[model samples]
Target: MARKAYSRRARVTGTLMLLVALGAAGCTGDPAAEDSPDAKPAGGEATTARAEPGKYQTLPQPCRAVETGTLDAMLPGLAQLDQEQRQKAYEGTSSVTYDSDRRTGCRWKVDSADAGHLLRIDFERVVSYSASVSDDARAQAVYGDRMKEAELPLPSDPREEQPERRADDSAKADRDEARATAPADDEAGQGASPETSEKPGKGKEKEAGKSEEPADETVDPSAPAEGLEPRLLRELADDAFIDDQLTTSSSGSGQRTVTVVFRTSNVIVTVEYEVQPKQVAEVPDSASMQEKARELAGLLAERLSDV
Candidate 1:
């Protein structure tokens, strides 16, 4: 009976030792096991920033955004050629939009004797659903993408040429005034000293003065100045760009297209103007079309600002 009791106690001791060893193993976690996929963060959703509200809450009617006179100027002969056509041109086709306040567009076209013009204007009011991004920022992104597609030349610094030109003109005017007064002064001095004969010297001085004066350069309004190519514009809105392209039509006529895109606050505006002559060989002028398109864009931008 004593031997049997010793064997039972030994078995009990062995069982206790096995349990203790198992518990110690469980307590001492393995580094590799702790780094397993099961230990990773749940769902793995990264925190993001909240978006801001847009500046513009509403958009204007695209069809009537531009004035009748402006349309007439852009599309010449719309009123003169045909009444039906004039009505059609004045009342541009509005784009179908589920939410007019969010986005809208209008397009108009008019054909004259030898040439035709088309105009399309689009207005978009950006809405930010995200909590982190602002409406203006989103619009800027969209505008940036469009600008990339255009790949236009860099815009010229209007300030750079304008101030220089003004200064030059002022200097030229001052020189002219001085020259005009000089003749009077010379004549008066000569009259006072008629006997002191320096006529040859006076003539030489006048000729030298004339030679030193720079001749006025004739600047054609239609010509785009050096370095002032049609390009992505800045300071017009939050951002803006003008894209001008000349392409040959299927019939071999030259088609000139001028596209202007600008973003003001949370609203974006696009103006597309094109001119194509009936004769395939006749090429359209890019500078004139670009100017007209930019003017139209400016008008539309002003209207958006008012809204």
Candidate 2:
């Protein structure tokens, strides 16, 4: 009887212990598993992010990229040439480049009965050597350097006066200001005569003269026309600018060079159009040259995207 009683007691104790263990587990809740999202990934190191590469890896053929019709239009003298001569003129001589993929250029010079024309086009494909830097970033830096070298005018301020004359004007203005502010040489009011003393009307007249001084009347011979001043271009490409330079020879014949530069993706295109009149009395037109150069630049930018 005693053995039977002891066995029943042991069974009761085992059941009570099991129930307590289950209750504790329910209150505490289960620990997060290793595969949980909150846990670290298999590798301790995080993945490194990389920049996207440039859109263009190679450049188009510089000499053949432009259409023959474009050539004829830019070089109007082509119309006067014979069929064989025109065809030969259309095929421009390619500039020598060690690596054509990196940089390439083409230029043509033609003389007509009235004037001379020179056209040049250059294409550059920029590549980034650093893994952290992108090609587009490098190209932007390069384009900025070119812009600085070109000495483009500020956006808000227009260069109405010539560059070489600015210093002279500034000096003159400074001198006038100094004279106006300078005190009269230690005049003794006690002994001052009426003739030497500055009269009220005389001082007023002097001030009026300073205020009425005429502005610079001499126009810069090399300055572009009012609306044709060098400025930033818009809607032509990602970013572009046009500059017109007019230089006259001793004989008074002017040579005008219109340059347009733009960048698309990682490629940069430049167009240089020059016109030099043969006659001393003749001068190149600024508006027409700028238009032609800008048009060529826009066309080249579009073709580069397609390529």
Give per-residue CA lDDT, model 2, range 45-160, as digits (tens). Answer: 65666667889988988888888878887888888889998888888888898999899999988789988899999999889888898999988888888888889875654477
Return the lDDT, model 1, position 277.
90
- Highest TM-score against the true fold, candidate: 2
Q: What is the C-alpha RMSD of each candidate to the true structure, in Å?
A: 10.1, 9.5
The TM-scores, one per candidate, come to 0.59, 0.68
Report clash pairs, candidate 1. 49-132, 50-131, 50-132, 51-130, 51-131, 51-132, 51-133, 253-280
Q: At residue 178, what lDDT does model 1 achieve?
A: 75
Alpha-carbon lDDT, every model: 0.81, 0.84
Q: Which ten residues in a row have the lowest lDDT in candidate 1?
A: 183-192
lDDT of 1 at 2: 100
Badly placed stretches (over 4 Å) of model 1 are 1-51, 155-228, 250-252
Global CA lDDT computed for model 1: 0.81
